[model samples]
Target: MSTKLKSVPNDFDSIEVQPLSDIIGAEIRGVDLSKDLSPAALDAVHQVWLQHSVIVLRDQRLSDGDLVRFSKHFGVLDFGPNMAWQPEANRDHPEIFVISNVVENGNPIGFLGDTEVDWHTDLCHTDLPPKASTLYAMEIPTDGSGNTGYMNMYTLLDALPDDLRIRLDGLQLKHEDAHTLQGELRYGLNEGDLKTIEDAPGPVHPLIRTHPETGRKCLYLGRQWNGEHRATFVDGMSRAESDALLDEIWTVARKEDCAWYHEWQAGDFVMWDNRCVMHRRGPFPSEMRRIMHRTQIRDTAKPF
Candidate 1:
């Protein structure tokens, strides 16, 4: 007897999927961000992103316009409120978030004077978080530094022993907008700027979130920090006991193989699902330059 198998489509002229790793990201080749993509091409890219959780397109050659256009294909883009960098871009393009350690005139912004960011999903403090985020690398550091690292929450869930998975089922945690950055307050975010974030009420979500698209469970601890609370006894445990539980879970979640590190290069674009991954940026030299433009896609569904 003969068996037939379906083949992956290779019809799109604009996009190509090349696997970067067996478990995480794919490198999409032959795509120019400047031009609009056909529905077929867009669908193809979306399918791969869902399957891989992260996708990197090299040599994208994006302008601000291109960044917005490419991002819109996925969903409505939501630019994060300014607390980090490029406040001007936040004002002009409501859909673009600029990530850079350089001045507009091509000068180093000096990392020593700036603050480092921690691992967290974009907009997780809000009731509605982003579905995915795309960052375009415009000028990368020369010394192979300033790489972004991503941890796969899906893998985190998979790695958990059966007993732990059963333990996390139906558990909920509170995510809040507590101010952790002292430097941000010192830099003078006005009442209006601060109010925008202050109004963001904390949300409660399952400890193990099931992806609406893929229907797979993922560990959903957005950022394991204080001020965020978890209910331990259904009636909820004391803050101290809950925090210790989270610390234990985080220790298990952060094993080295569950993460992938991407060294940035000029014209590299990285996009990942906020639902199934958490990311952080590494420090680079104070005198080196790096600029990145980001567009975030609003989450379409709630994490039950």
Candidate 2:
């Protein structure tokens, strides 16, 4: 898509807001996230995020407490998935989720180690998924590893084929909670927990969900693993039928026209709306080390 200029909000008069792409991302300059933002400035950032879906602030040096404090301006904090296994520094802050490839004492310092994470929303398996997610870069590989990409779901929905749009009107999907995005079973789960995708335990949500705030409808394909027993599929449909439908949806959703990628910098901070966007990470070399701290904003209600 081509780039276009958007008028900055009145509260953004002191900050420099630059659009990263036509559809998805914006970079906000001249703001110190470590210090508390004025109410007007915080609202200005929120407005930019609502318009762009994702916002990046460069050269931000934030501690775990600073990250939590800034993220709370958006909404209530949600506990990270690895709260039980947090590193020493993060043990005091359960809201901080560590994403890293570093191994210390023969144990990973964080999750999603060095592997490419495919397209998916954050915690969609839950009945009430997060409204937004934030990530702060601490250490990054020198060889340009771990670039993150984001897709604009609203634009994707608007450009959907008529047949597919019609098919999605009333369809609901089961977001499988049995496995992680990397196709591994979650902690304390076992093979006996789920026998088939048909009977898997998870949240049932509309295939196309309306954003509670924006009131815009968008496709919500939680995640589909490449295996005979997939994680997410259309609810109540036969396995074959659901697979065929999902295959069609993926063909359109995976198009690069509405996507933007961000290369990580040591002091970069990124926050994205989980309600109307999907994201993925590129795989990095195993020998490289990348450390990132993340936080999620809790949603007040379940998706309709």
Candidate 3:
């Protein structure tokens, strides 16, 4: 067990944080995120979040304001690139990025449009990527669809092959200017640095980043692929060499051993550390509906 998680005082309030998976998630019980919390309660929640990279709060009925306030407890918030993609109904609240596939009156209601969102870190293309992100599921499909999966990069990096670790050491990668999780150009990005996949807007991040808080190292491959194209590249390596290397990395990174898939429920709120975890959404039926509101916590420290 991580010392970071143990030795909790018996007087730690009425909080209970239970492990959801062997590696990645924890279910936070006995707190309603929609309301303001006491200082002690807030601290406990924050610590639990750090100890477990991803924490799921079930049955949360949070409004945009509640979500933002709850998210701000950890860090400043960011209206990431996804904000611009929100529909008119959600435009007034840029802090809330609407994720849905529902259509009404001939227009769609939100973003992510019923497709498989490949593995990625939110705002990885930005110079200052957000530190964390929280999503409140409003409505989910009746059938098991749109399951979001999270990978424990800390464990992933720790277990990496010696040869691969040595190769990735001291290396950097330019994460693709993320237009979308599906790699489509985001709204109003065509004329900017994110014009094409080859020459798009993205931030250069260390291939192996040391966590600012924990000082733990993790593989930070931010969205390695966009469709069939290489959305990222190992700096200083030839295109063919980078691609070959990335292919091998993906072979290990995408393995199920390091992942946990979340089956969504209405009012289930999940917040994950963007710094040490990469997440993806499974494909869903276009006809079925899935609505979620997401908020991001701004980054404070850069990856080393």
The lDDT leader among the candidates is 2
- Output the better candidate (1/2) by lDDT: 2
Whole-model lDDT values for every prediction: 0.70, 0.85, 0.81
The candidate maximizing TM-score is: 2
Ranking by lDDT: 2, 3, 1
* Per-residue C-alpha lDDT of model 1 across residues 55-120, encoded as one tens digit per residue: 898887788888888888888887545644434453656676766676655554323222345566
Q: Candidate 2 on 1-304: residue-level lDDT in tens?
A: 3232333344344677788887789998878899887787887789878888999999998989999999999899987766344444536788988899898888788888888888889999989999999999999989987899999999888878898889889899988888888888877878786787656678899989999888888888787554234578788888889899888878877776778999899999999999999999988999998999999999998988
- Model 3, runs deviating above 4 Å: 1-12, 80-92, 186-199
Task: Tell me which of candidates 2 and 3 scores higher on lDDT.
Answer: 2
The candidate with the higher TM-score, 2 or 3, is 2
For every candidate in turn, the CA RMSD to the true structure comes to 5.8, 3.0, 3.5
**Worst lDDT 10-window in candidate 1:** 226-235
Per-residue lDDT value at 97 in model 2: 89
Tell me the deviation in Å of residue 233 in model 3: 0.7
Error of 1 at 69 (Å): 0.6
Candidate 3, residues 1-304, lDDT tens digits: the string is 3222333344344677788889899888777887778777777778788888999999988888899888888888876345333444545566777788988777776777887888888778778888998999999999998999999999888777889888888988987775665756666765466554446767789988988877788888888444356678777887788888888788888786899998999999999999999999988988898999898888887778
Q: What global local distance difference test value does model 2 have?
A: 0.85
Give the TM-scores of the predictions, in the order they appear.
Answer: 0.81, 0.91, 0.88
